[model samples]
Target: MALQRVLAVDDEPFNLEIIEEILEDLDFELRTAASGPECLDMLEEFNPQVILLDVSMPKMNGYEVCRAIKSNPDTSHIVVMFVSARGSVEERMEGYSVGAEDYIVKPFGQGELTAKLLKLGHMLLEKDILEQQVEDATTTAFSAMATSSEMGQIVNYIENIANIDDVTTLAKALINCMSNFGLSCNIEFRINDEQFHHATSGMCSPIVLELFEILKSKGRLHEFTSRILVNFDYISVLVLNMPEGDSEKHGRIRDHICFIVSVTEQQLLAILTRNELCQQQQNLNGAIAMISSKFKGLMLLLDNNRKQNEAVFKGLQEQFEQRIPTMGLDEDQELFIYNKVDNAIQKSVAREEALIQVRAAFSEIESDLTALSNKVDEK
Candidate 1:
């Protein structure tokens, strides 16, 4: 890895040289600027990790310089420390007010300044490592979900699961997945004056719910996700739900679980249509088999009235073509059809006397994804 870059900006040549000597032993790529303009120019090309700025410059002082650095999105996250002879409590407050992270007074020992810089550098390195881990984990999750058919189908409708028209089987599948991960969760979706609730195993604590409530009612706030962590565990949260808004990094965390929610009513409708189509196809298959069997003998028996029989058969064919459009099934409809077909299968396989046998098969495959969503929301 490249060495962490440090920038020291002061108008006085003597002060800049002294700072270079002080930090000579540290593992950093040190750069210096003799004036405020030179600092800004160097910032454009140097991209330092931290900047030590002098507040007593002749023209643009440290406060003004810090403001310029913080205002620019590219350099805002860079640590800025104000160096000056002013060490009073009021001066420290003023320095911080203008975006200075730390204030250092002149006539200080070289060891104290070097130690502080080392600590700050380590914190930045740690934050960078955490960000990389998060990116890696996100990539792994998407890859796993993409390849697993069962997980893929369920994840396909993840955003729409809450509003799906037929949620029974899909909900069951979601719950099963959560159980596999050892998470207990509940879902509470509200619209206008109405509220809907679903739970698998454990209910989220009141505090967690309240955090969500505040987020919803007050809109996005600073450090929103960090505030939520106070009430929920890091491993437990998969996605932190937010109201529809621009994506923002609300806070830093060791294990950050962030969600991006962008839902519309049209998407919900499409899922419902898909579900209906899956159910219809299943029904049509069964109906065709039964009708074909019942008519096989009758067709043979009508050999004598061939002309009349031919007309009747043509009419039936036309009716079937005119009514069924052959459009695809949506996710919600697919689940509904799958459930209806499955229930029919279970019924044919065994009577109420053998209910446990049929249910055992279902228990093997079905899961509860909403519970996972709830766990993520709780966090």
Candidate 2:
């Protein structure tokens, strides 16, 4: 890691000496100034990460100097820590209220000063790393957005089309995007037999509508005078009032508009796909919920049948036990009949327990499915 810079501003020369002696052994590049004005001057070249300021100064106090440093965007990021003899609560509060990160007393230990500075240094390093990561991510996103050889501004606008969900907003966004190329445009988009129209200034004239109809019928690109019309299966874009004299510029503009329209048609397809997926998801969720409800009802019926079967088995076992002693038979025969009844009762109980477990398992699965369905709906 690079050495962090430290700027200490104190009117007292002895205090500056103390600070230098303590911090000189550490991993820092330290500089000192005798007054507030001198400190401000040194800040230009010595862009320190942390500033050790003394509260009492000659012309400008530490508060004033700290405020000046903070108000300027260039130097605002530097950390300011007050090192002064005024250790009262109010004095420390005053220092902090003016944007000081820390307040240290006059009789500070070397270890205390080193610990504070080290913490601040680590924090500044982390902050720098975060800022760099954000800048890099932004650069990558923009680069990905402009993969084609089109205007960067228009590419950015085209990239945002996937995020738009409403037709009216999409129309407005399209108009704004074309405005960057200095073209006055209007759009007529249709989806599922619903029509949406937007223009930059006034309502589109009847001639423009007629031109759109003519292009749609012919299924070809058309350029008449200064107006250009491009038609697709679902949408049409009309670029009007092109600069008439510059044929080269007009041709380029027309080509770019066509490219944009092609990309927009793909986006419209995505919108349609998204809508269809949402509808399918809704239908699937409803089906799952209905199945879950029916399964719960089945579980209740099974439970009732199991209870009735258990009661009948218990009653039969009781009757067999009560009549066993009274039956006139050999001892061996009586013992055999009792054993048969006991075995049948045990089998019945085990089967009922298995059914209960199966019902519980089904209930758990239904709960999981319901939760998953809700999550999909939220998305």
Candidate 3:
């Protein structure tokens, strides 16, 4: 478990030789492959716990090779680190998405490569120790709980979590589900931009929480000794004990744990999305209400203006008729002035009609907005 074996795969013979030369002093079981296919072929026989994969190999690139290795149940546990000239963020993310544990750029010094490997070596040793502890600590209860069928538990878990709207409730549901499988575990969930960590017996210890933070980006599934760390998006789960003595049960449990964590992550996302939508709906409702109120005020003001305009037109006609005879104006002059007053009154009537049309349009707009808000509420 001290990182005994390492396989370096590259298209360039010189690059492979350089890797070998750099690690020669570290006493590793070093091997080299000239192509990606050769590297895969060596996996079954050499079975190195770590792979130094070059990104730009011909035929099958390093990303593809890493994906293949991680997808295979037999070799999925092998850690992959990319050794490549492409050091961009996009390239590194691609490497991780395909199950590479770490990324190292080309022309790395001996000290850097060795130091990273040494850290991995420590991790392997810790994993071995954890495995032994799990085997030693496993009880009769766990063996009895391992009936090899987790479908029912999964079904119930999904049912229980489907309608969960709060992170605390969801966290408790997960802890209880794992307990049903006889697992003492710690779980971390990132919900609504908040982080919540829960454990079987109590809150997650400081060290366990730190481990979750460190291991969350390691991959979808990472095992150390007797524990497996499952991660997806904003969810991370650490199963405290795995049945080490029973390989068949262990494999089944590992798969089940992965599936369960994936479902939990999905549920957490659903909760977050649902909350966001609800907030948006509320905002829409508020906007509609405000617009409707403004429209109502405009209609009232228009109604008052229409009544005032009619009163003014009536007073002008009455005043003109009464003053014409008193002023002893010529008949032609009186008739001309009367015609001008009538034309002005007609224009005011037209404006009143336009205001009525404007009021109708405002009512229609308000109705449409109200209906849209109702639709959002239904969902």
Candidate 4:
């Protein structure tokens, strides 16, 4: 929808008059309130997409009024921008703490207010789209992690998380735990810069993921009316409907959710560690196979070299014996030559013996590697 409807709440009539003059020619259908209480009284009748709330008003300050508006499920979705003279970081931060979406200091330009409202108007439209998408998600069919004692259910989850071998199962278990407490939640489990999300309304919507990014940094617990967000380091769970109008139940639910998310974070960490180890084991096994194959190739090369040496030396010795007497040497000279030739052949035989020993050493080392691989598997 266009940025048409707006309610400007300020005690000073002059300030309200200035807002009127600025917006007189603009497209905004503006209304003014003299006090915080009056602004709230007009909220339902005006039903504005935006509320330009004054920071300092008699009886009700902007923060308190904004808190009231935000705490109410009916008006929580309306965008609130604090209009105040003080635009310090501290002032803006205070506004945000009360769930104000934007701020405008005193003496803001017509262009500045218009631009900010337009920007927030676009935000509201986007929020509507996201909400619709969330509504459209398939509802999850899951058996709640049922138990009478909330602590007992948590204990069961702690025990069951270990058995959840994958991200999907872990997400489901967490969702089931939330369902047991009568809370509908969307959860994100992040590790190693990867995100795994689940919703009680089926797979997590992109909108829910967007919310995870937006509210995850707003401390451990962020509440906007009935919606509760419990954020931890690696896990964020957004409860869709925290029981409204029940302070005690709300407090208990928040505590339960906080603990559950904490536990889920630990479990997610463990799952990541296990996955990393399994991958490492797989890589190690591949490396071992390659090394073993190379070792066998080296052994084969050694055997081939030994055979070639034997063949070459045997051929030379046979030729030497056959051609020796043709030189017309004496029998004694021939004997001397025979002994020398025998000694030289002995050298080749000794080399072969040394090669056989090297092969035996390679075999021993290969066996050792195999044993080590087995031990790794056992461990």
Candidate 5:
């Protein structure tokens, strides 16, 4: 197999020699450029996996070179590193601002450069495979005809499907365009739990299907859709997946995936919460029954005690009249019995009010629970 390519750009011969010497033992094909323009020219013929650029160059600095490389679609995906004698944090940040993968100080060891290159090489390989697949699938050789009514219709179709909630509709529209415009690929799609689901039709071989399953298990709300587009010749698309490091640029990628993952997680949490609410409703029902039963027993006991006391009070006058005279009691004793009767009536009234409040609270809890049950069912 051919070795991975590395492009080293520096104005100083000694620095270039040092870089070359550091990688002399490594197993890659090394290419050297003395300036930014020369590096860009070499890129046309030499597709290097990584570009190690010196920051302080004469005509075009490392930042400018990085900017140029990134602006061009052909070299944008290539990994770039800026090397400099001025290793201040500000300089490093500037290098990164221009799309450099890493910033290396001039006095760096061979192991450090080698390690960085290895990591960047793997990432470049993955990006290349993905970009190639997308390019091949999108490329077409049809004639460029003048704009017509059909163009307007196609634009309208794209606009309408662009914002639609249904992924299936959008996927179908995309496939229809491919078919009508003599483009490659057929699309088939569905909606799984409010998110889009899709697969390239006529290319669902075991490997492709397995890829779909892996993505599905990964779940919906993905920042962007993972798609496979086969050509008119039914050739399968191969996209490479690269794992990311903890860098800000990497975070952007993670942020996208996280947004989708959160959507799925939110949906799942809603489902679980609904189930929990249902269980709570069941528990609430049992509690209400117990409260009602206990309150009814208490009310019955209060009523029985009230009736017996009423009977005693009614017969109290005769008993007092007979016993007070026999025991030589006065009218003051009769006054005391009336006072005791008033106190008992006041206490009974307070107990009745408390029972009413308890009943009211039970009704409120029942109403709220019913509302929650409806919400769960709607979900």
Candidate 6:
């Protein structure tokens, strides 16, 4: 370690000698100044860590010198200890008020002087270490906050884009999200053999595009150069211009990108599936409507045929009653003819009941089809 620099300023030559002797055994580079003016002159080049100041001087006293040192930005950090013959409590308080770290009485023991200097040196070292730790902690906290903010934005954007049913619009939204983080990105989505692509600029390099395909097959996150590529089931996102030399920040960005891509892929797939199901439902509804129309036509034809058969049977019954009575048949023959006519009418009634049952069954079928069509429409 480098030696700690110490400047001892005392107007008395004998006092300076005594201070030099007291601190000689310590690991310090000592510079002595006979007056406050001389000390101020040496401070620029000496840049001592500690200043041993004497209060009683001819023109410029140690109190004035201490205040001057404290006021100057360049020399304010140096520790100033008052070494004076004036040892009263009032003198000590005055010394402290003037920015002195400690006040030592004149005729002090070698042990006391050495102990005070060593303690101040240790304090200075601890102060430096503590300041460094605080600085480092502050830096880490800011970094974490920044990463968290970026991730939050990514999640919110994914949610918003999920509501968009169009693949092209979703692709554009993804691009905008990446742009918000100051990243250049190229995205591609392959849904049902349809290709959709969006890029930050006009076009991405061929190498990057090829890598997007390769990474998509891998279905994971990959990093190369200043770019990171994340892949999902049917989508690939290429994030470019990532920061270098900061491993922590890079990892944060990579994780965020992967999560965003994964969620977006799921949403896109759901939209595509829903669209396909809707189309199939439409086709099914059309087929059902056509069958219903055909059944309705068949029902009309059956009604017409039933009415014509009834009219023919009635005519036959009228012909039997009129013609048989005119031929002078016996009573038994007339009764047998009436029985045959009644049997013909009963057979016609049975056929008409069977046709009505068939028509009722067709009507139930049509109701079921209509209900199914309604259910599909609701979906």
Best of the candidates, lDDT: 3
Note the residue pairs that clash in candidate 3: 127-225, 130-226, 131-225, 131-226
Superposed Cα RMSD, model 5: 21.7
Candidates ranked by TM-score:
6, 3, 4, 2, 1, 5
Cα error of candidate 5 at position 11, Å: 0.5
Candidate 3 matches the true fold with a TM-score of 0.60
TM-score of each: 0.39, 0.51, 0.60, 0.57, 0.36, 0.84
Q: Compared with the true structure, what per-residue lDDT tens digits does model 1 show for residues 268-315?
A: 345556666666655655655565555544444443345454455557
lDDT of 6 at 188: 83
Q: Report the lDDT of model 3 for residue 91.
A: 96
* Higher-ranked by TM-score: 5 or 6: 6
Q: Residue-wise lDDT of candidate 3 within 116-209, one digit each (tens)?
A: 9998888889989998888866854565565435778899899989989997899899999898888999998876566788899888898998
Of the two candidates 3 and 5, the one with more favorable TM-score, higher being better, is: 3
Candidate 2, residues 136-204, lDDT tens digits: the string is 898767655543434776668777987987667777877887887788987888789776677888577
* Candidate 5 wrongly placed segments (more than 4 Å): 1-3, 128-379
- Clashing residue pairs in all predictions, respectively, total 18, 0, 4, 0, 1, 0
Report clash pairs, candidate 5: 221-260
How large is the C-alpha RMSD of every model relative to the true structure? 29.3, 26.5, 25.1, 21.1, 21.7, 3.3
Residue 258 C-alpha lDDT in model 4? 88
